[model samples]
Target: MQVIPLKYGTIFKRAFGQPDVFCQFTKDILGIEINIDKVHTEYEYPEPIGFVRSKYDLFAEDTEKRIIVEIQQVKEDDFFDRFLYYHLISMVEQVGGYQAYGFDRTVYTIVVLTSTPRDGSINFSCAVSDMNPIDEYGRTFVVYPHRLVFLCPRQVNDKTPPLVKKWLNFIEDSLDGEMDEVDYPDTFWKKIMAAIQKQTINPALLSEIKDDAAWEEAKIRFVAEGVEKGLGKGREEGRAMLLKQQRETVLQAREMGLDEMAIAKLTGLTAQELKKITK
Candidate 1:
């Protein structure tokens, strides 16, 4: 059946928004059993705590822990830093009133990268990060419950876990073209796939997919033109032209409702640089 790629923001949100699919996914990927009634998409902190805010792709919480799942189709230079901030912010938000700064619930962040990661050490299909402290005497402290997991579908191999591999394979296959129903025989997989079937997608989502495609094409064209213009000009001129293009792209992305952090990721601009450009 023709399946819409889950790499797209709208499609990803739609499929995983269902509680069962989300629970099944987290169970397989994180090996955690969680029962959740609602999944929040594009979730933001109700009150902005500081200058920066976080908007998560998928967020769910039970009594003991909060789960965040982010799907990043575009590779960001500060991918690790960005997600770390998101993880911490979720923990920090728990503190209220004059109470002690004790965290009531642990936070778990799962980042799924559809593209190959730029970091060499992240060659494996799955990597986990946590706050397990170790002493010089080979002693370990397992105090912190918070954890971060990175999943790169493109890096799947023989060593990858079978269930995790199947999930990743589904994501990778959908991006390529039509996905055979026979390949996803599991009831859970079939349910997830049905959520993103081409026939079920409404006209509004179809338009969004088209707009995303156009934006990607425009970025490619812009980069190509910038490179050609740079080759035809002096070093200083080329730098100036590139900077101009970057500023224009930032403004366009903002108009399209992309956050500053997202724009920085796509343009390789720093927060300060983005502020200056937008100002």
Candidate 2:
């Protein structure tokens, strides 16, 4: 049986939007236990306090922490910077008065990337940003509790923790429409699997999936035609034209949220070549 992938924003929000599921996910991924009163999806602050307003995919709060979870399907050039801004916003919003210099709640920003990340150092399924103050002798002090965590399901390996790996594997399998409850024996996974079953998805969500598929197909055809046209030119001119086309396609695909591996296959470009083009 086919299951709707949680990588999609709509499906992701629907599945993890539940308070219990969100809490379980947080505990599994970050090793933090939070009893959130509610899970807010596509959450926006009531008033714009900064020069630019930020909308979060998932936002929740307990007494001592503010949680921001963002699901990113596309690999953008400024992916890191964008999330950093969101993380800061969550922290800054706590400022109420001039005398209140201390933040009451610690902010935790967790980013889940469905596609391969642009940073090569993030070669694992999960990683956390280090904000501890370190001395010359390597002694560290935890003055700051705010944290940033990144989860890349596409990068799972045997080294990955079993609890985290199961969730990452579930995400990978869902993308291929092959999610199985047997593989995810946890009760939490059972609930998530039932939540995103293809047959149970609403009509509107199914329509969105159909539209997205059509758009992806169109992008592939566009790349193919560009390659064909470039090959019809003079030998030397054709090579240059083809290179230009591939670069343009790479940029377009990145903006459309297409993963790097798929873009390389479609453009007939190697990983090194794609990196150069993107750079």
Give one digit per residue, the lDDT tens place, for model 2 in 2-50: 7877677778888888899889888888788998789998899887858
Over 4 Å off in model 2, which ranges?
117-122, 211-279
Best by TM-score: 1
- Estimate candidate 2's alpha-carbon lDDT, on a 0 to 1 scale: 0.83
Q: Which stretches of candidate 1 lie over 4 Å from their true place?
A: 117-122, 227-279
Q: Provide the lDDT at 241 for model 1.
A: 86
The TM-score values for the models, in the order shown, are 0.78, 0.75
